[model samples]
Target: MKFLFLICAAQGRPTATPVDNGTVVGTLGPVDDDVEVWVKEYDEGSAEDSGRRLAGDRLTGHTETVRVRGGEVLVTDGPFLESKEYIAGFDLIEAPSLDVAREIASKHPMAHYTGIEIRPLPE
Candidate 1:
């Protein structure tokens, strides 16, 4: 099984730079001594609705605890980041092709709202 990470970068603010390739799990940065990062396990056919339901649920569960510095708290529905390049959310795609991965990503809940960058884990 491979793991994929969907990271959000700071919008011209003091924040960690998004790493392109590395271990699936690691601390990207810290806030109040707490490391900020996300992790997900991926296998074939993992980006479909069934997979998304589980993954989305997991991410949503942690929404309250995840903090962004200088991040706006939305009173109404809004995009995840204030920056154009910042990631709003991610899906763990098990497909072998980039087109397939991107297609899966394009249908994600966050895709309609913010940008989603789909990159494979470095072997």
Candidate 2:
């Protein structure tokens, strides 16, 4: 099974801090052979630019909302939520099961400071 982990933080880039990637890689090495992981961060750009960039890629960074109502298009910047939390990055990981995926997500270095939401992909 494959799981997508949405990494959320308080409205900033995931790599904004000087995190030691080596440490994280070492921590996850045990599961590395069993799972395939792809990590991506949101691009540093204006909301409109980010949205446009995301349209051509598999990952989305900062977001914009467009709603059509009564022939009018309403546009809004930032995430859909009213809270400060925003999705900063994501990890697409292939694991043996949901339990294993959750375990792997929990081991992510960002999990200590931010939130990781795990969702299973269709087999």
Which candidate wins on TM-score? Answer: 2
The residue pairs that clash in candidate 1, if any, are none
- lDDT per residue for candidate 2 within 1-117, as digits (tens), equals 666788665544333234443322222343233222212222222232121112111236657989999999999986677777667566666666677666666655556556678
Error of 1 at 38 (Å): 19
The reply for model 2, stretches above 4 Å from the true place, is 11-61
Superposition error at 101 for model 1 (Å)? 0.4
Query: lDDT tens digits, residues 1-123, model 1?
Result: 222436343344343324412212222323312211222322223444333212432233223334455786435344554454544344454555566556555544333323456567665
Candidate models: Cα lDDT each = 0.39, 0.52
Question: Which candidate number has the best lDDT?
Answer: 2
